[model samples]
Structure formats: structure tokens, C-alpha cells
Target: MPDAAPPPAATPLAPVPRLDAAALVAALRAHTGEEFELVGPLPGGQVGAALVRRPGRREEVLTHWGGASDATWARVARTGALLERARDAGIPAPRYALVARLPERIAVVQERLPGEPPTRVDLALVQEMVAIAGRGAGLLRERRDVPAAELHLLRSGPGFCLHESLAQYDERTRRLLDLVRRIGTGHASRMAGDDLVHLDFHPGNVLVDRTGTVTGVIDWDSVGRGDHRFALVTLRFDLAVPGTGAADRSARAAATRWLDNRIDDLFGASPDGAATLRAYWAHMGLRQVDWAIRHHGPDDVDRWLTVAAARLA
Candidate 1:
């Protein structure tokens, strides 16, 4: 008998559909039975948004949509509940008017707040924002009901860490990956925590008035239970991104310094503080690189990889 032929390799699944203005408006109308005029696209969202004028409402609201799994949807609902609790406790955050779960996407209609992100993040502004975040963290500290499994970081999909993805990259990235693995393994015990963490807390997600007052914090899609220090790690990385404008560059430098000082004040005296901080930084880099690989171009990948490499080095 002739030898049997080998099975062909499996084809990769197609990327999820990104909802644009038209699609978002349609989804909102279908799910909520409310018509909204498309204002325009909101800037700086990793997941896209459509600013829509709601009928009979004086102020405009935002409809945000992104590719999401069932688990993601569950987490979003949990986050919305957490936000409501935070609001009750005097924490400033967006109120979710509606959360529509479509076939492969989830859309959230939230109250658009009055302020915009600060044009320049000076030290004073950073201090104010940190205080605001601290208040929210206080509310989160009261919650002990979320499951440990759900608290674990989900890196966009099933895979949690970056080791597998880094294997596909060059030697430089792999070296970074090795360091990430070492740090993560050393600090694995500290990964689980009961505090509510806004995994993507950063300047872009922060809304501030003209006077640098934090009016509202948006984008609760990545909220979960973890060390609050992890959130600060994310903020530091966000501030360190290379910027095009002089103000942006200065703000980044200042914000980075402010966050370092704050972290030092909070944890510098602990025996394991430095190691724990390094571990969180490594995790942030891995998370950014993995997400960029899937959603962005090579240059984006290289940029985040470089950031991670520098920290790990």
C-alpha cells in the first residue's frame, strides 16, 4: 500500500471585525432602540469609539466597541458593577448607560464627561491624578468577591504570558522574553491580589478639566483584581512612550519621575519592593508587546519590545 499523505497545516483564524462609525451606530440602534447621530471618532482609544448625539439628551455620549470573547463580556459586566460601587464611594468614573453584546463584539454606551485629557501632564497634575486614582483604589480594596481565576490577567486571549509569542521574534526580543520569564517566575506568588486594578490606567484614559482636575476616568474594559502597583507600572510605561511634541516629551519625563517618587514612597521600604516592581514592569512590557504584535505593525512591535528590553536590561 502507498504511504498516506500528511495532513495539511491548519489555517489561522481571521481577525475580529473592528466596528466603525456606521457599524457602531447600527449596533446601538438595534440593541438600545435609541437613534444617535454620529458626531465623529474619538481619539486615543485602543479600541475604537464613536461620539454619538443621543436623542433628547443635551450632552453627547460615547459608544465604544471592540472584539470580545464571552469571558471578556463577563469581566466587563463585573467592571461596570465595580464602577458603580466606586461612584457610590465618590470615585469619578463614567456611568455605563448600556452594554450591548453583539455576535463577536461588545459595545458600551457611557456618559461622556465634561473634560478632556490634559494637554500637558505636569508634576502637580500628576499628583492630583494619583490622588484621584488612590481614592478609587480605596473603593476597590473593599471588594473581596471576585474570583481568583477571573483576577488573572488575560492577555487579549487564552495565552496569559509572552513566552510563546516571543519565540517567533528575533534574538533581541527573545532575550527580553527570557528576562521576563525569570522575573515573572520569581514573583509568581505576588500576582494574585484582592484589590481592583485598572489594568490600562494611563493619561489617555484620564479625563481632566482645564484646571487639571480629574473629572472622570473612562475605559473600564480591563479592570480586574491585582496589585495596585501593577497599575502604576502601566502608567509609567505609558508616560515613557516617545512623543512627537515638546510638551508631550516634557510631560512624559515629568510624569515618569512623579510615578517613580510615588512608588518609592509607597513601597521603597519593603524588602521585596524592588524585585516586585521589576516583575510588574516585565509583565507590562510583555503585555504591551504581545498586544502590539497582534494589533499593530512591525514598528509598533519593535517600539514596545525596545521599551521592555530597556527596563529588563
Candidate 2:
């Protein structure tokens, strides 16, 4: 008998196109029927932003929310609606003018708020932003809207803490994960609230003027209903990440102290505040460590683990 023919190999999936400045500019021009001059790229985590100047219009930011599944896009739509509510409440957020849902990517054109991200984050400005966020939270509390399944705390989605990534780390990190797992058991209940939370409330997402006034709090893609205090803890960890530049490092140190003071104040306000803070800390720690494991190298994981350990202690 003749030898059986070899089976065909599976076809490889095509790589997704990079959402660079040129690509974004083209996409914007195509979707909006307007010409755009690329200004520069803005810092982002899950998404990418570009500053573009349209003819006879103020500078606008075009955010490329990269390709996502339909479910994820649904969540983004809900988040956009929530942000609209927040903006109506006078929160410093952008106005979404156009949202283009394409086959391979999503692009949003937003009104560019004035001021730049502070080279050195001022704690006073951070506090003001947090207060504004709290008011937005209050608005969310009145509306009994539930986010999509993917936006839930326990969902194994991007930015949500998952346990599988812990296996990629060292012994010390594993030990920390043990504590985190224990603390996370009833965390959903503890964190349950109607307040809208910015899951990534870091300094980079906050825009400030020359006088250190927070002009806008950008990046509301991960906005959802949760305990507002959870965001405060996320900001604490964000301020502690080691930066590559001298100014950033100095800012991190000062901001860390400021966050520490804020945490202390929270603890002093209520007897159970410590436990609540610890739970939120574990959630933030897991979120950071898991994110580092996937997107960064061992050194980054170690740096985040150090922050996690300090919080656990």
C-alpha cells in the first residue's frame, strides 16, 4: 500500500497591524472625512493615543483602542456611556466625539483637554483628582447600572487579577500570592459598591497645568462600579513604581510618601479600614504582578513584587 499522504499543517493566523501614528492618522481621516496632522504619541497601557491637529479645529486626541472581541467592545461602549455621565457631572474627562468600530480596531476621537501631564506629580493635585472621582462615584451610585460580565471584579480579563500568573514567579512571590489568595476569597463582597472606579488611576492618566492644577483625568476605559477606595489603593501602587528618569524617580519617592500618609489617614478613620485597605492592596498587588509577568520581564516583576510585599507587611 502507498504511504499515506502527510496531513496539512494549520494555517498561521495573520498578525494584527500596529496602531502607529501613521495608521491612526489614516484611520481618522478615513472615518471622519477630515485631514489630520500627527502631533505625537501619548503614553498608554492597553490602548494607544495620538495627538492630531485637524484643519480648522482645536487639537484632538485619537485613541486607538486596538482590536478587541465583540464582548469587549460592548463593555467599552458601556464605559463610554458611564464616562458621559461622569462628564455631565462636571468631572474632568474628555468628550467622545466619534467612535469608529472597525473590523480589526476601534478608534475614538476625543476633545483634547488643556494642560500637560506633570513631570513631577503633586500630591495636592492627586488629592483633588481623587475628590472629583469621588463625586463621579456618587453619580454612579445613584444609577443601578450593571457593567458587562467582563468588567466584573472576578473576570479573568485584562487588568483584572488572576491567580494563574503567580506560577511564573519566584518563591517569595509565591508566598505573597498565598496571602493574596486568602485575602481575595471574600474580596468581591468587600469591594461591592455602586461607586464608579477607575481601575487604572495613575499619574500618567492625569493631566495637570503648569500651576499643578489637575485639568483632566483621562483614560476611563476601565471605569466600572466598585468601592471607590479601591482606586485610591491602585494610585498608591502606581506612585511607587520605579521610573527610568531622574525627575520621575524623585516624583515616585515623594508621591510614595504622600500615598503612605493618605493610607494612614484612611486607616485612622475607621477600625475596619485597615482590613479593607489590605484587601484592596492584595487586589492591586496581584493585578500589578500578573500584568508585569505578561507584559514585562523578571526585573519588572521583582519591582512589583517588592511593592506587593511592602503592602502585605
Candidate 3:
């Protein structure tokens, strides 16, 4: 058995696909003439992945995805090439060893990059993460092939960034949903510009070494082109989450505020900055809240509501 990838790029995720290591192993063998064995479950991704080893040589990360349209998967297949550009700009991303597109799913085998998931989140970590986000600014400005990142506030996205959860939660959430919907409809349906948007940019998706330097940014399943500042907003919401790290609640709040201040420092001079921030903020709010409502219990949802209230209220 193996873990699945992120859900589709269209409609609701009903009967989704799963990852089969044997099928991928077969696919890789057929495509690249490689022999690999499933190692273990790789932790710390919204979509699950597994470690696959090429004995006596090196290891690779294996991911299997489905439900996205062929066009979407085609765009996804191009991400590995996009990584080359990211690497050129000094960003640490992995290279795809192979891509096996089967009738039911897409299997990807990529060269494994270094570092383990960061065990804790601190101010230094925050700064480094924000720096990582900054490194991606305008990286894709010239690449017209990549699609714009959808805000997903006005409606549900493929399988994540849902909007209906907030609408059903309660009066408070419904009001917040209204704000998010207003922003979603008022702003462009998709994010503008050509920056490299790690649609799920957060500490969890980042891998780091012992000294706390980020070695690689993993999980580009939903990667797209958009304003890099949107990533900071996503990071902001993640920091505001209860156990994302930094010792305690107050410290997490401080780290989030510090990040916001950094955004202000960079964007306070630009007229569109606040507006851009708010739109992204509302989108992330809907994403987190919707996921919490559907997956976690009431308290978890409540915590996210507090986070949303900071900006949406």
C-alpha cells in the first residue's frame, strides 16, 4: 500500500485515486529501467508520500496523484522542469527522476533532496521561511505556460481551499465567509503576476538541516504562478495556528505579527499592498477554516476562527 497525492484540479473529490508502489515501481522500471523498493512513509505533507530506495545507488521520493484533468496533470508534469529554473535561482528543489502517467493516475519519482522536516518553529525559522518566500518573487514572470493560482474564495477549489465550510459553520463564520467571498469575487478569480507561488508554502512543507537552514522546499503538487506575497499570508495563518511551534500561544502570535510587520515594511509604500494582503488573507482563512471544519473537532475549528478573526474581524 502507498499514500495518495493531492486531489483533482476540478469538481469535488469523490472517488479519488490511491498510490500503488508496485504499479509505480513497474512504471519506473518500464520508463527508466530502474529497480526500486518502497522504503517507508514520508511524513509532513498534506498529501502523503513514501520513500523509495534504489539499492546500492541512492533514494528517491515517490508520489502518485490523480483526479486532475489531463491538462492539469500535463501542467503538473512540467513542474520538474520548473524546478530546474528554481534551482537556477538558488532555490533548493528536487529533480524528477521519472514521470509515469497511467490511465488512472500519474506517478512521479524524483531525486531526494537533503534535510528533515523542521521539528520546531521559531523567529529565526520565521525569518528564514519569509526569506525563502522572497526568493521566489518574479521567478516565473516570463513563463507564460504556468497557470495563475486560484484564490478559491468565491467557490471551492479542486479538493482544497474550500469555501462552503465557513458558510455553514455559524453566524461568525458565515460573516467571515461573506468577507472572503467578497474578496474572491471582487479581486481577480486567480492571483495575478508571475511569481512562483508555493500554493501550500508553510513550515511543514519545508525541510531543514540541524542549524535550521532550509535545505529544500518539498510538495509542489499544487504549485502555480502568483504573487509571492500570498505565500507570506499563508505562512502567517500557519504561524497563528495553535501548535505550529514557537513554545507557546503568545510567542506564535508575536511571530505572526512580526511577519505581518515585515510585509508592511516591504509593502506599506505600495498602494496595492494592503489590498493584495487582504485578498490573500481572506483566501487562506477560507482554506484553513474549511479544512478544520470538515476534518477536526469543534476546538480545532474554533482556534482557526480566532486566527481568522485577527484579519477578517
As for candidate 2, its clashing pairs are none
Model 1, 1-313: lDDT tens per residue? 1222232133222333344778777877887788777888787776566677777885555655355787778767887898887677566878888788877677787888878976776677667666665654545555666643221222224443445555455555556677776665566633565666677788788888888888887777667666666777777777766667887788778777778888877668778778877777777777776666556646666677767765567
Q: How far is candidate 1 from the true structure (C-alpha RMSD, Å)?
A: 7.1
Give per-residue CA lDDT, model 3, range 1-313, as digits (tens).
Answer: 1122233234332322345566667766676666778787687665578889886968789997774468757776778878888888877888898777766667787888899988777777889888877778888878898889888877888766666556555666667788888877777888888888788888888889999899998888777888888888888888866764336666666677789898777666778877777788888778887776666556666777777777667
lDDT score at residue 133, model 3, on the 0-100 scale: 78
Give the residue spans of candidate 1 off by over 4 A: 1-17, 59-73, 148-164, 295-303
Off by over 4 Å in 3: 1-34, 243-254
lDDT of 2 by residue, 3-104 (tens): 222322432122233358787678768777877889887665444677888779988888766676787677667777887887787778888876877667
Q: Candidates sorted by TM-score, descending order?
A: 3, 1, 2
Which one is best on TM-score? 3
On the 0 to 100 scale, the lDDT of residue 212 in model 1 is: 81
- Give the number of colliding residue pairs in candidate 2: 0
- What is the Å distance of residue 73 in model 3 from its true position? 3.6
Worst 10 residues of 3 by lDDT: 1-10
| RMSD in Å for model 3 | 6.2
The stretch of ten residues in a row with the least summed lDDT in candidate 1 is: 1-10
Q: Candidate 3 has which clashing residue pairs, if any?
A: none
Where model 2 places Cα greater than 4 Å from the true spot, the runs are 1-18, 43-47, 66-70, 148-155, 159-162, 242-255, 267-272
